[model samples]
Target: MKQTATLKFIRKHSALAPICLIILLFIRPTYLYAEELKLPDIGDSAATALTLTEEKMMGAAVIRNIRHAGKLVDDPLLIEYINNLGNKLVSVSNNKDYRFNFFIIDDMSINAFALPGGYIGIHYGLITASRNESELASVLAHEIAHVTQRHHARAYDLGKSYQVPVLAALIAAIVLGSNGNELGQAALASIAAGSAQMRLDFTRANEKEADRLGIKILNKAGFDAHSMASFFEQMYKESRLYGSQGPEFLRTHPVSQNRMAEAKLRANQMQLKQPPSSEAYYLIKQRIEILNQPDDKALLNHYVLQLKNKTYTVREATLYGYAIALLRNKQLNQARKVIQQLRKQAPSRIAYLITEAQIAAQSQQYAKALYLYKSALDDYPGNTPLTLNYIEALLKQQKYGRAKSILVTHLRQPSPAPKLYKLLALIESKLGNQVATYEALAHYYYHIGQTHQALNQVNLALKTPSLDFYTESRLSARKKELQDELTALAKKPS
Candidate 1:
């Protein structure tokens, strides 16, 4: 009886249950409340449903909303590490030219979802929940498989056939609406009158397909494919242990014994590659453990106990986490000492260099921070975190010219960061280059999915009196691009 009650509680209070798998519904013929946000084209229900270009448009819209919510982890190193793993899978997958974009949401819910145009988000809870990098990679591979299979597009077609506009509205309500009872009531109301079971069946089919392809991709990508089945089995056991209140993942993605057995059998057929433990994977997981919890000192004590008990899966990652906790607690000397020990243990590690540079910056040792940043950049040229930090340190020292030069050079690369434009705008503002500042802001807005705003800003830039031909040419071209985007977005059925 007690166990049943616990299971009920888990079902009632699942962290991400309200928003689970709703991303897949995007770009399908469901009228969402995206009108409230005034976002760019949220894709209409065409006979063909989802086109590649329209899917990319929807991805931009979803990314902006998630980003503005500040739910994504802001750390660059963790993002880069996840991207490296994602790229590995993408490189080996059937869709070789896919522009896979992976992101981490700060939520502690153990769930992941794929969006249109190769966008995927994994909750921080999912990352920390994994027993190994392969387990994590398994989840990622599953999500990637969903994207590559165009499962969302087919799901959209199913929704169109159901003619359930309310389903889409309910998802939008959960995502863009108020919190607490309002959210729960909206979800309950939707479920009470909707074909919730049918939706689940649709999603289950996608899950089964993703698992089949994911295990294959996992093997090809050199990950321990068995880890996929193992992780599923572990989640099932964990759900039972937690009174059937499985992770948010299992709440939305139901798992069965038969499914687990099939995954095991398929994985067994493939000879395992047995990749070594990823240093960045473990270290990033530990650091994210500290990052997710609000109280640094409390988390520090938790790691301390874990470290002292010597019960951790990865000792080096624990120590690295301990050092970061020390730094957060303002124990600068202790942090430095611990990081030095870490450096001795792993001298050529990029994470260690980043941590060391951060410590120097925090301790008001700007020169040391600059030197370390430059040194690390020399080794890993164009590294986002290193370059961003280096530019920041220079900006802090009022070296606008140096910072601007570096920013310009970084911007010249194809696929320059959206953030660099913001940084460039800051530098322009400092140097009092009004036209340049607006132009930079324009590009930043455009990249972040606000095409109309970008167009307005570029027009403002072009209005500047007596602009140079070079600057005018660039601004004019940018304005034209933004206009084209806005026109495309306008033509899409809202």
Candidate 2:
């Protein structure tokens, strides 16, 4: 049956020849069943097998590859919202010391996955498919449990010779493979070749543990405890309807009737709390829906129909999405009118304010856009979306110095997005700061997993004429750091 499944997968994804070739070269046919491996108790034994720092590095490398592949949804608003939601759950989690980074994948598949480290990715489809924030939070909680429980490390502890880099590559391939891209398909096909199972399988014991712990976390975090069971029931229903063609999530995180019943029972025994979903959840869902539509006119028309027919769950969010669609279509007047209505309803709403400012910018009314951005920033200090939009408007108005100052200040915060560095690189280039430009560009490339390009950029910066002692020393140190990282990556066993 496993061989049959593998053959079916290969038949379905024949385009993955290139990636399969690479995988075939390295991976040997091996079957490691979860039940066959004894899971270490949650303690130092697992940590000894794979250090936290090493896990983090592996996760970082995978994330960089994902970014380089353009698989991430880079919208600041969506990213900020997901991170805020994720962090809320993390705050109440048992592993408070672990730093969690949450991101969204652009794929329209109902799936979410946890990397070896505290990196969690949710597909946009999963967000939209969720009935409410509680459901989304439930999924996050489960993934977090997987991470905090050190499941990956425990697995490595059991499978002593399993290469860490190979595992990381397998994870990357699994994630990208679901997107049905050539490389992803190849990776998936290769994985199937190596292990007849096409999906990442955690132990049955692990899934039950995650479900139990995830419910506790959800209840503590003020989400509905029953959401896990509710989501499971939904997936179970989906599987019934579509059989093998069910959601990508089902393929990875398998759901069974017994599991669903257990989750429901566990949740019911808890002090259940069904908190109302946040306004941001609704707004982000609509925003993603609009942004995902490739046809601008179709999006605009769809929104128009929704608004006209009053078919929206949230009127304000629908209007907000409509405004975004109009903006995309360059319908400045229509977009502004919709945004004005939204602002009137909730004047302080950041989404509406940002959209209004964007419309002004699109109309070439730089002063108006700048004023709107400044006013919004004053009200909501240090807001990332507002700050980024403000910087963009400043750049457009040739206010390079102010833009650079504000951007530099923003970069001081932890884990600034890669786009910020790219913007800084552009700003430096425009100012004719060749050294700074190369340095900024190097940072951008480094963050996005293009280590070779980043290294070359650093070399270019070092070769630039007349570097000050501090500048030269900084560049040299950065060059060495990047080189060391590259060397380590190269040393990983195939």
Candidate 3:
């Protein structure tokens, strides 16, 4: 049968029409799939239903991504000890489905930050500045609240549109190999260009929520809720005295009179069951002081004066802090004298023996640093940090082969810090492995001259997916320096 004019027209256009339709589908996916892809309502209640497992995976991903792009401090004992404290806090958290991790950054800035899951960073400066364990716990507890409350996810959901520019900046750099400064400048510019008032309001709201939740969590964990108030009180006083130029704590985290009053009121409301300080708290405190404390000499002198005035607690804390200073300064005999007194006063304290061993090492007494580390291990076996310290002492004595063996064996074990990877890099560098040497050398070079580098290397490092603040800073600085250099070079007489 002969076809009608309409049918003939349809037959001729069918092939081309389907192809055109397919092209439209590819180009305008949003219109086609908008209903299916719409985001869930990011109401306050919606955040509560986010699974702990999802949070953990996201948190761990953030940790791993940032770790790859930055340098983590390589102290085993410190990392393990802080993780233990974090675990204790997690045990008492209202939401205990997820695991908490604590990492100590080499950064001296007095700040603590949390990732979406359970990744918490306790800055070396925060540890040093804290007067006691409860002060540190206050910071940890606050971070734990951030995780439990799903603040990261909630923030992401609320500000998904705002992240577009930051995300674009990152993607452009990765795709185009843009100069480090260009990428960092792009990212920082986006942060600066955003609505500052809105950001501040959000931050303040989160901070208040975190403060109340942290106090409740601490009280439940048998910590003194008053300690949180006390910690902020000290920080507030420090802010008044220093007035904006003080430690980094005041810079990133602002404290005000209202905050202090509110914190105190919250603390007063809580029925805290205070518990005695555990051995872990004291040990971590000792480690913090040893690794930190800029004015060691003055600290010792002050301690002596305090002792003469019969200020027992300050005297005790200072003596413990001073003993480590003495070891570090190579005053072995003096350290021994201080530790001997400490041993007499607090017999069976493992910290004194550890200090004793360190002093012995400083005085060419390897046998003792070795013996004391071993003795501490015997008392506290499975102490990965102390064991690593023992291995380090051996390495100090030029026992590379033995240290290498121990490091290799432990490489198979769980390591929060990449100890084995570091050891392998160091050992291979020592053995004249050119490839290994350059890899380690590149890392060192980038770390030491962070803000300045060959344009090529700076551009390369900026391509990393999840840039940490340090890497971000380095890339920014290097980019500026290189741009300036190029401008000057272009203006030369040649």
Q: Name the candidate that leads on TM-score.
A: 2
lDDT by residue (1-494, candidate 3, tens digit) is 01132234235444322322222221111112212325343345344333565455444533433343453455655777788777777778776555677887666656666654567777777886777777788888877876776554433321432332233232222212223244334443443344311110133455577788888878877788888778877877887888655665654455667777888899999886666666556666656655655776865665566567776444555677777767666677988999889888876666666677777877888887887887777787656666677777977777777666665665566433444455555765566554443333343433332223345455665665677788678667866765553342232121
Q: Show pairs that collide, candidate 3.
A: 77-385
Clashes of 2: 0
Q: All models: lDDT?
A: 0.70, 0.76, 0.58
Better of 1 and 2 by lDDT: 2
What TM-score should be assigned to candidate 3?
A: 0.61
Model 1 TM: 0.78
Residue runs of model 1 more than 4 Å from their true location after superposition: 1-49, 155-209, 412-417, 446-456, 468-494
Q: How many clashes show up in model 1?
A: 0
Name the lDDT value of residue 159 in candidate 2: 37
Quote the lDDT for 212 in model 2: 81
Return the TM-score for each candidate structure: 0.78, 0.85, 0.61
Please list the Cα RMSD from the true structure of every candidate, rounded to 1 decimal place.
Answer: 8.2, 5.7, 16.9
Per residue, candidate 2 scores C-alpha lDDT tens digits across 376-438 of 888887788989989988988889999999899899987789999999999999999999999
What is the C-alpha local distance difference test score of candidate 1?
Answer: 0.70
Model 2 segments beyond 4 Å from truth?
Answer: 1-33, 36-47, 157-170, 178-205, 489-494
